[model samples]
Target: MRRALTWVVMVAVGIFAAVGLWSAAVDPAPVSAEETAREVSQSLRCPTCAGESIADSSAMLSDAMRQTVDQQVRQGRSADEIRAWFAERYGDQVLLAPPRSGYGWVLWVAPLALVGAAAVVVLLVGGTSTRRRWWAALLVLAVTSLAGVWLLVPQTTPDPQRLKQEDPPQVNAVAVLRDAVDHAPGNAGLRIAFAGALEEVGQDAEAVEAYAAATRLRPLDSDVRYRHAFALVRSDDPGAAREVLEESLHVRQDHAPSLLLLGALVHGEDPDRASALLQQFVQLAPEHPAVDQVTAFLAGQLDEVPAEALP
Candidate 1:
């Protein structure tokens, strides 16, 4: 029996060793602290999400902002200067992730506090057996180690999307929208304008949220709804676009633009059904652009007829 127990222990040790090796092989090598900090900050919207910085956005404007960051970094600009550049352009709104001051301190402290509380709880539970307490201590140690590692790790990689959310190195139209959002938190028009700016610059995700907020504030406005749906489509989130289009249709039937988009979407997925919708579209507006092209395309599927029968 002793020999059998010894064999089981050996097997367990071998399994653990293999797992450790596998994990090491699969885990990526640690990045520089600076790169890690950059990635974490990137893609994080400014507090309102409408005031997204280049680091937090994937827009064309954000791309330009990122290029500026790279140029500045290469030119030996200080971290403070780089951050200040964005702060100057978009004001405080361009910061991706909150600044590490004021309310921002809360974000940094919450995780650490949770871990510390857990460790304290484990220590206070003295009624547990010695072996159980040891295991608890080990768990707390692992958590503490991970927290420490997170603190030490630098953000190194720069995300272009985050450039929009991060402070811009310069002032521009997006800055205007940011200012507007700051002054009028409850204004739907201001939100929509910011969303458009985001889309114009290629920050689709932030634009999506901004558009959503605009629509929520003015659900009766088809213009806002259409823009919201269009933004969703631009972001390549067709599922959301379709749903919004349907909602818009429910509110106002025979909306030609919505019909056109839905018809295209439906047709892309199922040609036969789309063809029927195209016919309906023709009946609704014969002189619409691309009408002849669509009709000719549909004609290919029908039985051939002589020119004399043509409309």
Candidate 2:
């Protein structure tokens, strides 16, 4: 019994050591959509809120980025692919970790090369007798092989409790927000947040309804109404969007977005009115970047309202 207990303890220690080595080489594998989204978000820097990953940020842009990550994860996008997507859109600074390819690869290779050289020197210097050298070399080879296998091979725990701990129950952020909205049916902020999250994932129709509810709750908020119109346009309800934009302009005519979107919405049906709204938008917001686009629109182009035209 004593010998068996010793053997069991030795095996357990070896298993844990192997796990430590493997974990040092790579991150824990994400086993569910929520985990995958979290892992991806944690690896990317939040553009609006630096120093915090999107996973930890409460910034609006971070929320959108997280939703995008979740959608892509559900679509089976690989982590590298999702990282590349963010890099392409937001530039390389968005990645918390630099790419392992290209010139940066030297950074990764150098440490490993140094460690290998150190191992070689230790083996040569530590071995004095031929018999000792043989044993040392054998031990080194065994250790290196074991490490290589541990790093390369995928591991799954057979214990149910460990598996439960490793992969907690997946939670859907959207579903959670939806439940919050259901519980607080009059909470316009929850409605708007849930709507924005839906819009981030391309659920335009549902976002339109959510934004519409927000608009009704906060009719005086020009920004809320603008979002409602924008969501309406995305859902192919341009007629209703035009009416909402018109209503927003009636309340706040200085609203550049309402003028800009209404101009485009009416360009085909009412050219003269479209030109007037476009011309007014340029005069009211001359320093705005969209002014140049509006100028082109006045000249002959019908500019599509870019997303988030208000702010």
What is the C-alpha lDDT profile of model 2 across 1-311, one tens digit per residue?
44544554565567667767767567677778888788788877655543566787786556656766776777789877998876765566666655556765675466556556655666777656664455445454445544454445443213433333342222344664675476556768878988987988899999999988998898888888889998998889999999899889888989987888888788778988988988888888899877876676567664553444434
Mark the 10 consecutive residues where model 1 has the least summed lDDT.
302-311
Show model 2 residue runs off by greater than 4 Å: 1-171, 301-311
The digit string of per-residue lDDT tens for model 1 on 86-159 reads 66666655565455567766866777677767767777774566654564555555555545444544323335
For each candidate in the order shown, give its overall lDDT on alpha carbons. Answer: 0.62, 0.70
Using all chains and alpha carbons, the TM-scores for the candidates as numbered come to 0.41, 0.46
Q: Which candidate is the best by TM-score?
A: 2
Clash count of each predicted structure? 42, 0
Model 1: residues with Cα > 4 Å off, grouped in runs:
1-171, 301-311
Question: Global lDDT for candidate 2?
Answer: 0.70
Residue pairs in collision within model 2: none
